[model samples]
Target chain A: MKNAYLNFAQMITGIMVAVLLFIHIAVQKLGVILSFLGFKISDPLAFNSMMERARQGLWAGIYICLLAFGLFHALNGLRNILLETGLSPAKMRTLTWLIIIFGLIFFALGTYVPLVLLTT
Target chain B: MADNRPRENSLGIAGWVWAGNYTLERYLYLLHRVTGLGLILFGIFHLTATTIFRVQGEAVWNATMEFLNNPVFMVGEFLVVTAFAFHALNGLRLILQELGFTLGKPVPPIYPFKDAIRRKRLWTLVTLAAVMVLVVFFFIDFAAGGPG
Candidate 1:
């Protein structure tokens, strides 16, 4: 049952990652297109511009969603990789908890910055 | 009973890339794993970097971005883009398979695998071609002094 649940989660999150990532990349590409059309947006890496963009509702929401999906997909995928390496079941169980803890910490850290930026 | 030696694990750390006689599907699997790991590492670095803006100030964050303007970092950015491309494409392929869309239905053992492979092969090529197009654009941009 645990394995089944994990598989289901992987499938759902994998789809989310694909969709969100494509949207992210398409937005970047759109920037280039806009640049070519003589609408020179500020440097995307500029701190001010990033903060301004984060303040906007759509971009902020997309980023928060990306953060959630990206963390779950990557950490769960990492756990899957580790399990495939012939670890004992006991070690696998321990590693699973470690991954969950670490993933939550990183997710919190990641989400906090965006939330703060979006609100302020 | 004949003494049967344990078979070597070709997918071991050192051998995962170069040890196996791989089909295209196997190669795709390897690339997916490699790119996935690379992107995850980059994500960690990116999260840490972005956290600087919140923890430090805008000045520090700007300083970090300025530091990343170096040529070496530009090259790293290019590789990150490549990794993202592959990981995203192969991830789509995996998702399709998981959803029972591209893997084909179950059948008898006679040439059973070919149907599944045939169904997915076109998509694999299409995704690879899309990545190549993105790579070309990235290379052109990098050559034009863009940060990729």
Candidate 2:
């Protein structure tokens, strides 16, 4: 992708990450308060509750989305950092491709957790 | 005659910590990078750990959770939460500035010059202050609402 497109993607994915992370953390940590507020699950950290959340298709989908967005934004940011450290053009290009591959692997592994439970 | 030898005064990675002349904005830039790097590392570890936990099944997951249920981990989690608050708020401010929302219209340089940087400086401070407040709130929530 062009630098501009990558930057735009960074901004958009960043926004999504902030929103999703807020939901994920808030729901996980504040499960008791949320449950009192009629969220149903009182202990989100409990193994059963964690599995329950993962099993929900909507939550699983959101988890996958978060994984993808977080990985892309972070790896792109990593690429930018690496480029700024002053590499040769060829080195920078190679590094960028490396990061892309690394990000894809991480995303696959990250999503597998949620997908595993969701399938079964 | 322009003598263009390789500049000897390059600050390098040290510049990320200390440049001779740096304003709050510069320091904020440094903080942004530091927190971003830290968060990225934390995120990767988090994802990897969860993936492993999922693979190992509930017994291992609960055992790992039990192991991590400690004061040190709690403190570390608080720091991560604080870092996230700062990074997210600062990132939003940066996005707005990039989009020209936090900036003023361009004006020709007069005897007394002014531009978007002034407004942006204030926006940075405001954003930093907001991060502080948000972090405090998160702390309270974390303290009051333990692993639930």
Candidate 3:
């Protein structure tokens, strides 16, 4: 059961990573187009305003979801890597728990981060 | 370079220096580490800039904008974007492996232990194609003078 849960988590993380890659590529290409059109959107005011609206958009929500998936995925991956090393089972279990806790904390921070930035 | 003879067959500690083993798992692991570090560096820069913008107001923000507009900074942005793209794509591969999403294994298979990892190479090719497309776009942006 534990193994199954771990596998499921890993898979979800993998899929999210794949999708996020595509989004990143598409966004950068869009940036190139915007730049070519002489629409310099890097200044704080313009960039912030644009991102603010995007942040409130459905896509932004999707990004936040990816952030959560990525945080957990990386943490879990790290845990697995360590486990494959020479660590003892008890230590591995403890480390795994710690990693999970850290993942949760980071996930919370990820969501709070953009909102906090947008606000203050 | 006379005494720098290559070690035959035996992979010493430094063998993993440029990504130790060439195994699938090792490749993914190294890529993950590279991307993770890249993103973390960018994240720090991002948050630090935001903090400065909040505290120091427009003067600092304007200076930052000027600095970021420099060609060197623009190149750095290109690298960061590439790092992000690679990390995200490779991350998906790791997720698929972890999930046991083999090619032919249907959910609740009669023969559960069938080797479903058949199209592994195909998935890798797809990822490579995606990365190549991004690199092309990145070059175009860099050539046309990238973001500030």
Q: Which scores better on TM-score, 2 or 3?
A: 2
Off by over 4 Å in 3: A20-25, A34-60, A97-105, A116-120, B1-29, B40-73, B91-126
Provide the TM-score of the second chain in candidate 1. 0.75
Fnat score for model 1: 0.24
Model 1 chain B is weakest, by summed lDDT over 10 consecutive residues, at B2-11
RMSD of each: 4.7, 3.8, 9.0
Report the lDDT tens digits of candidate 3 across residue range B40-136. 5675465456444534544666677667677687778778777876776666665555556635335564654433443466677677678778677
Candidate 1, residues A1-120, lDDT tens digits: the string is 566798788778877877887676544433565467676666666667777787898886787788888888898889877866777678878998998899899888877877777778
Candidate 1 lDDT score relative to the true structure: 0.75
| Model 3: DockQ vs. true structure | 0.16
Q: Where is model 1 chain A poorest over a 10-residue stretch in terms of lDDT?
A: A25-34
Question: In model 1, which regions exceed 4 Å deviation?
Answer: A26-30, A37-40, B1-11, B18-20, B103-115
TM-score of each: 0.84, 0.89, 0.63
**Least well predicted 10-residue stretch by lDDT in candidate 3 chain A:** A43-52
**Model 2 CAPRI quality:** acceptable
Give the per-residue lDDT digits (tens) of candidate 2, residues B1-148: 6532223436678978886777777787888888889999898778876888766888998988887778887788888888888888889998998988976766678857654566578888899899988777667667875653
